[model samples]
Target: MMLTSAAQAIGLFIATNIDDIIVLSLFFARGAGRPGTTSRILAGQYLGFAGILAAAVLVSLGAGAFLPEAAIPYFGLIPLVLGLWAAWQAWRDDDDDDDDAKVAGKAVAVWTVAAVTFANGGDNIGVYVPVFLNVGPAATAAYCVVFLVLVAALVVAARFVATRPGIDEVLERWEHILFPVVLIGLGLVILYSGGAFGL
Candidate 1:
């Protein structure tokens, strides 16, 4: 059961971090095989994700203590609505996250990367809070471990993607459609189960 829950946690991590992959790819491209860039970005990503997780856990703790069980599921709407909006924007060729990521510009440092990671993750906090609340302590612990491990995997994947030319066209063509679908699926599951995979 614990192993199953740990495996299921990957979906939550992916759902919450839909845009981060593209952003990380761009940053990796900016690195252009520069020294220390990869290390800095990895540190920043971990630091930023840690911040998000910490904040979500705290908020979940408070909400779990005070909120009724039935109400907690409604928080799934956070991801659902964001997914819809992202889909709409992507459909219209108007995803501005690329623009936002570009503002990170030529300067790539740990703090800069961390700031971008945290700022971009703001919306994820809403989705995470309720998921954490309903997942129970044991499952949440498993999720944290799983999620932290996946962060490194995501970074490596993004860096690999950066090395590939014309990947943007592929990403542009399907990234939004794919990830938002997952987000929407995850949201519905949370709404239905009040946790992931029935916890």
Candidate 2:
């Protein structure tokens, strides 16, 4: 049971994430491909995710609460829309540099990224609910630890690829493909949980 729950946690986490490469590329583009800035952004992203994990733990422990059971279906609806929107953004993107321009013109600070990342992850809290409630505390802790390590590794890899001279262009050209795949998977999960397939 623990093994299956941990695997489910890891799989769901990976399947639902699109911000990984998006944020990594944004930092690299803005930081002039510097490793330090990429790392800082990566750190910030992980910190944001950590905050979500802590919140989930509290929710699971009942120190905090989730939306009412009656509201869960609607909460589930949000990620479906968000996923489709992200996919559309990926498909319509003209220039990767536009993100940098938006960031600079808007003067979006680092803390803003942290806050947005955290908020963006809110829909993902659903992924932890079943595992936390069913798998027991040890399994939950293991799931969280494994998720943290995987996210760290992914961030490091994204930073490395973003810093590479030619890879940035390749990633930029192909992100439309990758982003939609992730988004679609997230959407499907939400739909399934909402009883679209009677699961």
Candidate 3:
């Protein structure tokens, strides 16, 4: 039962945010050749994700404890709005261009990427909160561990792929094809799970 519940939570998480993970991996892939920097940034991101998930799970569990039953539905709406907003933003800005250039130095851009990572991950918290509420404490830790493992794997894979001679060129060329699809797909999943359309 514990394994089943953890699997369910993991499924929901991946269904809702796998695209973001992919894009984040790709973004970090730009720094791939530099193992030290890439690893540091990836570590920071994983830490941030773990922290947020822990806080969100605690908050949700607490809210479920104290809040009136009627208010729970409203909590679900947070992800709805976030998902729609993410979709809209993706629709609006299909371009992958960024204002910030990659720093040539080895300094960890923890704050900058962390800010973006947090914002990018905000909607996911709302989605995961509901799923987390259904799991036990032990399952929660298991879920967190599995998620961290998947993320670490993605980072390593992206770094490895980026080192290939022509892969970056291919990825860069296909950003237009990839970004919108991922954003829209993730957004729709979150939107549906959040019951944004009232279905």
lDDT of each: 0.67, 0.60, 0.55
Ranking by lDDT: 1, 2, 3
Instruction: Please give each candidate's TM-score.
Output: 0.61, 0.58, 0.56
> Which residue pairs in model 1 clash with each other?
none
TM-score leader: 1
After the best TM-score superposition of candidate 1, give how far the Cα of residue 80 lies from its true spot, in angstroms. Answer: 23
Error of 3 at 77 (Å): 19
Residue 84 deviation, candidate 2, in Å? 20
Question: Where's the lowest-lDDT run of ten residues in candidate 1?
Answer: 99-108
Report how far residue 171 has shifted in candidate 3, in Å. Answer: 5.3
Which is the leading candidate under lDDT? 1
lDDT of 3 by residue, 1-199 (tens): 7667667756865675555556555455434344466767677667656655765676667854543333333343433343355456545654654533322222445543444445456566666676666766777777777777776665566556654578766655554444345444544554454465474
Model 2, backbone clash pairs (residues 3+ apart or across chains), number: 0
What are the per-residue Cα lDDT tens digits for candidate 2 across 1-199?
7777678877877875655566456445445533356556666777878876887777787855454333333433444564476567655654564665433221224553454455556656666766688878898898888888877776776667775878766555555554445445545654565564454
* Residue 169, candidate 1: C-alpha displacement in angstroms: 13
Off by over 4 Å in 3: 32-35, 63-108, 170-199
